[model samples]
Target: MTDIPLEHVHVAPDDGADSEPAPAVFVLHGRGADEEDLLPVAAELPDELHVVSLRAPDPLQGGYTWYELDLSAGGLESSQPDAEDFRRSLDLIVESVDAAVDAYGLDADRIGLLGFSQGAITSLSLLLEEPDRYAWVVALHGYLAASYASLDPDGIESKPVFVGAGAGDRVIPESRTTAAVDRLEDVGADVASGSFPGGHGIGPQELEAVVEFVAARAV
Candidate 1:
């Protein structure tokens, strides 16, 4: 197990409006990507809200990866051996979110998580595993990992979730995306979903949907 530390860079509101006790959106990036890749997305979001983009723990060959992958194995390499270490990274992220909330005097009940691809997987997994931790979750171009099937949805029913996928996403099959949405709905999450005609990435329409979802729920 390797210890991975979560690193973050904050993007303050452009409005220069006095920072209110507003909820934050923690942005996570995809595989081989860095924290800066998704930080710009915050600009399109409501300026009244806070945005924090984080870097994954481990540095890969060209960039970074949240967990190791064995292409030969067909799926994620067993993170079991490194579960404790991996979880520690997640703990750091959670702590960071709490710190941001406290620092800004934001309403804890309004905090949310937003991630793309691998980051999306992490966001969804964390929310499912700790149902009461976040008020809302936005997963873009990411599928639900199988480990989430064991989660108890007692506290998650009222939590809002926005899931978006590319219709032409060859990496994540449409069936898998539909299944993920079904599972979340079944578990009581207020789920809203959409699919765009593109590859494994977010398009203009997808971004608009995300903005709407967050604006309606986070504020």
Candidate 2:
């Protein structure tokens, strides 16, 4: 129903900023997942904020993938191509977000990005590449893609970043998450990292931390 295509349908909360200028949250899903996967998490956020869940452009065997993958690669190598594809998709999404902000009379400085797995990689990439784009960034169960080393730290505007990962994540090692947190911090981002007891998925504590981060930034 939103202006984006059916594949990009965003399940959002009804409430948003009461003032003419509102804050917005863009939700990106994990690999093999659709936009709907994070819609429920939006409900846990402050009701006064607008939430938009974006779908990946590439369709996988059954679900979806942000970009191609090569299993032969080690660590972050397997995610390089997909990360690049997500960067390209982000260009279009940022334009869409600009249009949405204008249409809803939302504050541009209040926009935020929330992502999981591959989506988290995209979110962090965007933040590092375009530091001023979002007020805050939330990355769950993902690490910084290899391409992150090329980013210029001075370009970042010191925005708040929330990195949450599981201690038992088999897909994404906890070491990778810690390395990412260190990278973002070194790049002048005010980052907060948390670890959950579960596997490679969101837990209640992580969700609560994210909600708190978004709510604090929305004010």
What stretches of model 1 exceed 4 Å from their correct place? 1-5, 15-19, 70-86
Model 2 regions more than 4 Å off: 1-7, 10-19, 75-78, 155-157
Please give me the total number of clashing residue pairs in predicted model 1. 0
Cα deviation in Å at residue 21, candidate 1? Answer: 1.8
Query: All candidates' lDDT scores?
Result: 0.76, 0.77
- Which digits, one per residue and each the tens of the lDDT, describe model 1 over residues 1-219? 112235777766665576566667888888788888886676688877778788887887677767654344355422121355446657777877777776656668777889987788788888987878888999987777666755766799868999888888877665667777888988888999998889888788898999898888876
The superposed Cα distance between candidate 1 and the true structure at residue 219, in angstroms, equals: 1.2
lDDT of 2: 0.77
Distance from true location, Cα of 46 in model 2, Å = 0.6
Model 2 alpha-carbon miss at residue 160, Å: 0.1
Model 2 TM-score is: 0.88
Candidate 2 — worst ten consecutive residues by lDDT sum? 4-13
